[model samples]
Target: MTDSSSSPITVRYTCPHCDAVHSIDRAPDLADRSVTKHSQPGWEYATPDDDLEVRETADGIAFICGEDGPVTDLEGKQIEGCGRPFYLNFVRFEQGVELDPNPATYGGPRFDFNG
Candidate 1:
């Protein structure tokens, strides 16, 4: 049942038993999405299970959500799911809004990749 036929689509859920991984493409709405807590800070983590979701499902691999954009209250925590710490460059946006995963600029993003 899992193959190219199910490519580009896979069910996703955290194991209720032990936070294990769970995936299935054709579930009967039992695992339907409800608002889930953003799990990261600042994003207001959609606590009740309502909202749109974009996800990927595979074995042993858990979700690492950007949660609308980035996690807040970093207080030194790795920016949730990306293993990145907060940088001061992004202090302007309304906290959790993004056109893309990373920061964007009118012309292009400025990165310190050269060094």
Candidate 2:
């Protein structure tokens, strides 16, 4: 049996604007830093006027816009509203089993782990 604890963990980040997803393999030491970075305002290049809300989900974590909401596009620098919320989903792969290429399809970042 393989020790799941030491297995590589994949973190998927979904964009609220275009439903575009970005996935990154989590390094044990840098996990907290990655989470903190995503939990900050304008992390997605959103306007500074907007507030960010962090919530703990079964899977990993979620970052959503507060009252002001998503008021700008980071890449385009436009004032378009992306009302959708972003999610950070975590998944573990068993030994020899291939990891899913698209973690976004795992259904909105709901994981069984508390942290």
Candidate 3:
């Protein structure tokens, strides 16, 4: 897994009440379109705006505090992948990209790739 912190479009969310920022990472809303890349079929997606409901920041973006972390929804934030009452994440990994998992219990090689 490669460190995505410096990814092209890295996102983060913050809590307005307690000022506690919970990185929200959820899937996108694409019901009518099928994202296929090199035979890698992407999943469908939807956003919170569809339902006219705003989540936390309403920034319309999703982000994970780190790898292996629970997904969160920025609510009102405008994130790339999110929907009505979202709690997941959606992202497109371009070709030649690398992923570096965080240093947690699941330890092994510093990085990995499906192919």
Best by TM-score, which number? 2
How would the candidate models be sorted by lDDT, starting from the highest?
2, 3, 1
Provide the global lDDT of candidate 2 against the true structure. Answer: 0.38
Candidate 1 residue pairs that clash: 34-49, 34-50, 35-48, 35-49, 35-50, 36-49, 38-45, 41-72
Better of 1 and 2 by TM-score: 2
Off by over 4 Å in 1: 1-8, 13-17, 23-38, 47-115
Model 2 stretches with alpha carbons more than 4 Å out: 1-58, 65-80, 92-115
TM-score for candidate 2: 0.27
**Which residue pairs in candidate 2 collide?**
59-111
Give the per-residue lDDT of model 2 (tens digit) for 5-108. 66435444446545444444443332232222233332223222222211111234454533233333444343534545554433424496634424224335
Candidate 3 minimal-lDDT segment of 10 residues: 30-39
TM-score against truth, every candidate: 0.19, 0.27, 0.18
lDDT of 1 at 95: 61
69-115 in candidate 1: lDDT tens per residue? 33323242334343322211112234654323233323545676775
